[model samples]
Target: MTTFVLFGGTGDLAKRKIIPALYSAFVNGRLDANFSFIGVAREALDDADFRQRVLASVSASIEGSSANGGGSTPATLQAFLALTSYCKIDAREAADFEPLKQRIDTSGANAALFYLATGPDLFIPVVQQLAAHELVGDNARVVLEKPLGRDAQSAREINAALRTYLKEKQIYRIDHYLGKEMVQNLLVLRFANSFLEPLWNRKWIQDVQISISEQVGVESRGDFYDHTGALRDMVQNHLLQLLSIVAMEPPVNANPDAIRDEKVKVLRGLHKFTPEEVSKHTVRGQYRAGAIDGKPVISYQAEPGVPAASRTETFVAIRAEIDNWRWAGVPFFLRTGKRMASRSAEITINFKPIPYSIFGTNQRNLRSNRLVISLQPEESVELFLKTKEPGEGIRLSDVALNLDFAEASTSRRVESYERLLLDAMHGDLTLFVRDDELGAAWDWIDPILSAWQGDSEGLKSYISGSWGPAAASYLLAQCGSAWGEEYVED
Candidate 1:
């Protein structure tokens, strides 16, 4: 049987995402009968208590949320609960793993998957304890959540420790953004479509803008967010991973390593920002008090658990360029922030305008043809093209060939956590980040971190409800391109 063990199983992540995902997978027939689950945490709960808790979580997740498709029947939910049990063990207590080992062995579970859903500090300790108890068998696969470490050196240490206990193939370092349907569609969108491959290079594409904005400020994670900042929290992993997918070469094969090999090359090819370049190319901002959706919100410094004098950035915008043949001249604008105008994740590929427009200067104001891929708030792809206005003398207008993924499919869409969990269970590492890829990403991010520390003037401030600091707009303006839908009003 395949046993799935969740460390930190009583935490917010487990309650909010992991459990709901697993139960959803079960409901959709993605999990077989032989599979079982064990929830590991220090919570003082027995089988009954934990099962009841699981029931509440599943109800709220599957039944209460429309996005999850309300697919759970009583019989299936009970069956899923039957497959789950709880184990109380403190990660620091080595002896606690002994009983957990016995429980797994007693269940006759031969293949096990351990998911470390805890903080980064507990990752090594939990793995070490599992190793000492002989719980990390060759058939066992381990999954790690992100913010693997603050920077490259720390990331290397964590990776080195995992290497001592597991093989590279056995480790699944997850970045949940990758498991999104549209993000994965990037692969098929480029490779399967013959028309796109010819235009995917620098000559046709002008600038690429990838931005992830949040309308909500750091709520309960203020302490963590204050320490990590936007650079490490978002840009280092999610934004960069997205950038790699948008800029990577066609892999030799669709195999996990083949796809990841191309991604690593993109990371390695990223132009390192010198201190001068960092000041010129990067903009970091903290949110000041403002309203979001007609409600007042506090500034980042005024948030609970954040320092009153903190210089931590709630927003960061970067103008990045890949030092590769296909993307050498193209600039990638990456931006992420908290308490922005809206919650969105979008990638906009702006194509160059026609060298010669026969329609005259009035039509010159018309934007160029470009592709817009929206990842959140909705999942859709829009290709903007210049079309003639019917009934007009000789007028041109912009029209979009839009494909909304959610509306296009009748079936329920799988959530990111569900997709990633299923992939881990099946040992498909294509959606997971490899060790080298993680290292290279951090290596590229570390210099920017250092530069930010030495320059106090680098941190700017913006109203909470605004897109970001004005400097962010200027970053893209310098290249003569705006973000996805921004306009210069009269």
Candidate 2:
């Protein structure tokens, strides 16, 4: 039997994602009959109260999934709810862990998994209390939710503190993006296919564009977003993780460490930005008052809990280069922002143009071949190729070879959190971020943060429902490339 303990179990993260994911896993038969869940938080909720909350959360999740054609049975819901109980724990008080320990011990479970869905500030204290209570046994693993720290130094401190109570292998630092279906498919797409391997190089590839745009602003997280910003919030973990996967060399084997070893090399190979290059290669912007979907929205500063004079950036666009044999001069255009044109996350690999067009001198409008891997709104891979128009004088038109994952597979697609939770429960570390990987990411990010501090003029203002600041497009235009879909004429 394995006991799953959820810290900050009543918080927004637990309600919106953690608990719902756990229930989904259970409903999908991924969890065994011996499993149990304990929700730990400062909220004064008992077994009944917590069960009621879980019912509501699971109900809402099932409702949301119905929109996409899914549901659950009442019997299974009640069965899973029966295994759940809540315990209130004040992390600062060592005695608070006693109840949590007793609950787990009573279950006669040999292994346990602790998920800290709380703020980073409470990470060390909660782990310390668990260690002091002898709850972090050898079989017990701890799952940490991100924004690991504001920057490198603080991240190291938190990681070092975690090591004091747990071994390196026991810590699972999760970045949900890595658990996405297409993200994992990237491994197979690169290694399993023979056709793409030959063209996956700097010589054939012009520039790679990785963008994650959100249609909504910081709804209730104004305070957190103001302090964290897009660089630390999005770029540090999610975008860097994506970049590493897209740029990493084939691992020696399929082992977790083997894949991570190559990812670490990619991170280390990232070209460090100097103060001068920062101005030319990176663009930071804050969203001003604008309309999204024809609905008016507030600016970042005007958002509740955000400071009126805040200088935090809600958008970040960077032209990153990996200094390695495989990537070399090829630029990785990385962008992430809130209140953007639409909610989407994708990677577009633009292949270099033909040296000389044979169709005619008038073939200037012939677009080059490119591969697009869309991760959200839909999961699909599209290969754009220039073909001759029918009954025309070698007139070329762009056509796509699309492979939609949902249409191709009959299996039930696992959501990111659900998949990650199941992996953590079974002790699979491949999809989780390692400590050194986190450090290397922060190491590359720190210089940009420092550069932004000294140059206030670099922070541009962009309206909501836009791609980002005009400077973001210019950053790529300078390199003779553009973001996905922007290069096309509607």
Predicted model with the maximum TM-score: 2
Best by lDDT: 2
Error of 1 at 439 (Å): 0.8
Query: Which residue ranges in model 1 land beyond 4 Å of their true spot?
Result: 67-69, 488-490
lDDT of 2 by residue, 150-171 (tens): 8999999999999999998899
TM-score of 2: 0.98
Q: Once superposed on the true structure, which residue ranges of model 2 sit more than 4 Å away at CA?
A: 67-71
Q: Would you list the clashing residue pairs of candidate 1?
A: none
Q: Over the stretch 1-490, how does candidate 1's per-residue lDDT look in tens digits?
A: 7899999888778888999999888888888678899999998999889999888888888656776646677898889999999999999999888878988999888789999998888889988888999988888899998789999999999999988988998899989999999999988998899999999999999999999999989887889888899999899999999999999999999999999999999999999999999999999999999999999999999999999999999899999999988999899999999999999999999999899988887753777899999999899999999888899578888899999987799878889999999898888999999999999999899999999999988799999899998898899888898886586422
lDDT of 1 at 236: 94
What does the lDDT read for residue 64 in candidate 1?
65
Residue 140 of candidate 1: its Cα lDDT? 89
What range of 10 consecutive residues in model 2 has the weakest lDDT sum? Answer: 63-72
TM-score of each: 0.97, 0.98
